[model samples]
Target chain A: MNNELRIMQNIYYDNSATTKVDPKVLKAMLPYLENEFGNSGSVHSFGQRALAAVDEARDKVANFFGSEAQEIIFTSGATESNNLAIRGVVDNAIKGGQKVHIITSKIEHPAVLEVFKYLEKNNLVETDYVEVDENGVIKLDQLEKKIKENTVLVSIMYANNEVGSVQPIESVKKILKQVQNDRGEKGLPLYFHVDAVQAVNHLDCNVDMLGADLLSLSGHKIYGPKGIGALYVRKGVKLAPIVFGGHQEYNIRTGTLNVPGIVGLGVAIELVAKEKGPSKLKEKLVAELKNISDIKFNGDLENQLPNIINISFLNAEGESILMMLDMEGIAISTGSACSSGSLEPSHVLTAMGIKPQWSHGCIRISLGRFNSEAEVEPFITALKTTIEKLRKMAP
Target chain B: MKYTKKLLEHFQSPHNQGKIKNADGVGEVGNIKCGDIMKLYLKVGKNKKGDDIIKDIKFETLGCAAAIGATSMLTDLAKGKTFDEALNISKDDIVKALGGVPPIKHHCSVLAQDALKKAIASYKTRNS
Candidate 1:
């Protein structure tokens, strides 16, 4: 027991929030941050070197998404990528004096949902949210029904970070194709966007397979450095740049390139794309956790990412469980890291109609490459005992 | 939210937990938005000065660590004190007792203090 305590000093299981930068990714990024400092936009030899590196990174990233190099645009992170994709399309459509409407799922991350809300708030666009089942899968018929003559875009996530529910992107794409064909006679175009921040590392992200006209991804979610992400815009897609500045990223996004972050993101994507994730370890942990009474698992386990699992200890408070787990050096989260400090229940869970009490008690355990397969047994032991203790304290 | 070590201690093993059976006073406060609900139970008795004193205090709280810690500290701070003195135990006193709670969770300390006051008010009405 003492030996187990000694080794259990830093078992991180919160990969969905972010990942520790892979050492190989860090090794690749070091030169850019130190000596290889040059603006990709400049004309000097040093600048040419940086520009070449940037081009290489773009190609790698683009290849991971099954996109052409020119189609990928670098941004600050998934938040910025999401913002640029949604707002760019809507703002452009509105400028063309087209009545703009958007369709999104209720379980979308705030990065997507909040942008729609902002556009809707200003009367720039009309929006509708598609409902999800108890497992957090978007209802395809309901989504198709929400499409209107003026519906310019349908933005949905590739997978949910909190519950690990992988959306049926191909099905959504088929529905969009039908909608587009129906609207073709009227000369209307409906674009499909996906927030693939959580899905890029764990799932097949081929844009062709997913049928995404635009997609968003973050570096940190896949073991890259923070502050770097990309947006994939299919060639010939019209999108108004959100941030107006020096001509960069095909005039869709403008800023000095985050060279080190970009380089790290490329290597991280390459490394994680090959990883299948530790589902065996996850299943082992879940089976052990089920021994505790009244524990409910969230998301569609049959069709979801292997690394992320969310569960609710019926009578326990999520924050209390988080803190207790922290004390034992088992890091986890109650919901998205963006909304973890807030008191409100996760919007995703509520949208799926999970009971309020269960939602409040929900915590996500996301594994990653660094997590040892041997740690699963100890994690199970700690979680089982911790839930028992917290449940006993419950009123 | 970062909790002080003392607060963590209190939250893990609250000084006064469970319900006071046939309690003289019971107070419940629910933060609907945060989904935190605190129920405080109190038993009052006469002190040497013939003043109403808190004879027993217990709590059943469904909240974060700070909420549980603050309520636990409130019980410890108010026990054996006169009704007026217990009522005087402010949110600051609870915060100070547990080292401190984060700015976002200051309302937890406030919730604890408010629950105690409500319990005392209930006691006053019952005895009156």
Candidate 2:
């Protein structure tokens, strides 16, 4: 009886890492996973039923982005989607005998940054990284200056995963519009791609409205099943296939389709579309946290996603705080070098001009749709106690 | 890397935390850039055999779980021992007492050993 009383209730605030799969989405995917299972490519009644489900999912995903069904290409996840969008376009440009110069922001997820680095190292393309401001937003002037006449593609994330800063996609669209017109006069091709994995939950994602030639999103990040994602390739944007197999996903990505995952992704996107505005719990938590001394918040709070709150506690190391919280049945993430395999802290914080000492003390608390207001007070109480304990132990 | 159950217990309720007021000797090692800093305090006095002994020891640390656990274990090993015996306490001893830390955290035990040596040296320097 005493042991049962000592058990702490679990509270999860790591939604930005991944969300719990919704029960409705799982219900929608059950038929496809069980008796309705069939290879979408086979020629029979079972195959036709499976193919119809895939087509329905495709249409739902396409409708979410205001694109045609043929434009959406399913992949494993956002990493694959990002790889497909970037490598596919750049490889096509290279095959056309053009010297490719591509641009990406310094604060992009490694999926995009590492791909650019690989291309640059191999001499396949000339790459430039546009800088971000102190709030982790991309600098528009720097982006414009980095674009040379030979630049063929630019990739930027819709929202940063670590700090939750939302980039100014509208301003970026305007700049690209001007460049596109200039390049069009010379019959040159330039494309814009966005990694929208973190933005679909809270932001507008209509492909034409964002003026993106290609866009990437992951199912897991939006409360759908894992191992499924999609890429929005605009009509007339040519891309070479990176993975070779049976002709699937219009030859851009190949393999047997993940029918259940696809069905879940479609239902997840539709559900998030009806989700309400900014979370009041997040606002309350931030406001309460501000009452504590020696705490600094990262990123532009006004423009950031409603779910994420990144903060650094002076003198208290992040990994220590994270472990303490974990003991209390609360889950969070940290940017401390000690927590990661590599000794360096978060690249996003470093790119935003934060010092290593401050970056090592950073922790991220992200709320999800299923999280309730009742969980906030307990979390804050636990956090305050943990910080006090750590502060007392520190030199 | 995962910490052992023994290490987590030490981190959760560390031994002899905070400073000893007007300590006989104090030693601080590591730096903020490395993401760990350990400050050790010692109270040295003569034993019945007329040999210098550590009467009390405490530590304050700003680091991850391994750093704090290593320091806590070091204090437990060094207290009530003569200065020479305390100085002989190795990194392996502290690591062994706490089961073991991750390979990447082996430096934390090294830091603990260095802190003990520095404290003993400081006591000798003031008396000599």
- By DockQ, the best candidate is 2
**What TM-score would each prediction reach against the true structure?**
0.94, 0.96
- For residues B54-89, write the lDDT of model 1, one tens digit per residue: 999999887778888888999999999998888888
Chain A TM-score, cand. 2? 0.98
i-RMS values of the candidates, in order? Answer: 3.1, 1.3
Kindly report, for each predicted structure in the order presented, the TM-score of its chain A compared with the true chain A: 0.95, 0.98
What local lDDT score does residue A133 receive in model 2, on the 0 to 100 scale? 95
lDDT of 2 by residue, A110-182 (tens): 9999999999999999999999999999999999999998888999899999999999887898999999887
| Model 2: CA > 4 A from native | A1-7, A96-98, B47-50
At residue A231, what lDDT does model 2 achieve? 97
Alpha carbon RMSD to native, model 2:
1.9
Per-residue lDDT of candidate 1, residues A1-395 (tens digit): 24355544589999999999999999999999889999988999888889988998999999998889999999999999999999999888888577788999999988999998998898889999999999999999899788888888999999998899999999999998998887775566789999998888778899999999999999998899999999999997889999999999988999889888988988998897777655587887777777878878998788788888899877778888888778788999985211256766888888888887787678999988788878887777777777777666556
Give lDDT tens digits, candidate 2, residues B1-128.
88999999899999988899999998989754457788999998889999989999999998888889999999999999998898888888988999988988888888888888888888889989
- How does residue A254 of candidate 1 score in lDDT? 91
DockQ of each: 0.50, 0.69
- Per the 3 Å backbone cut-off, how many clashing residue pairs does candidate 2 have? 0
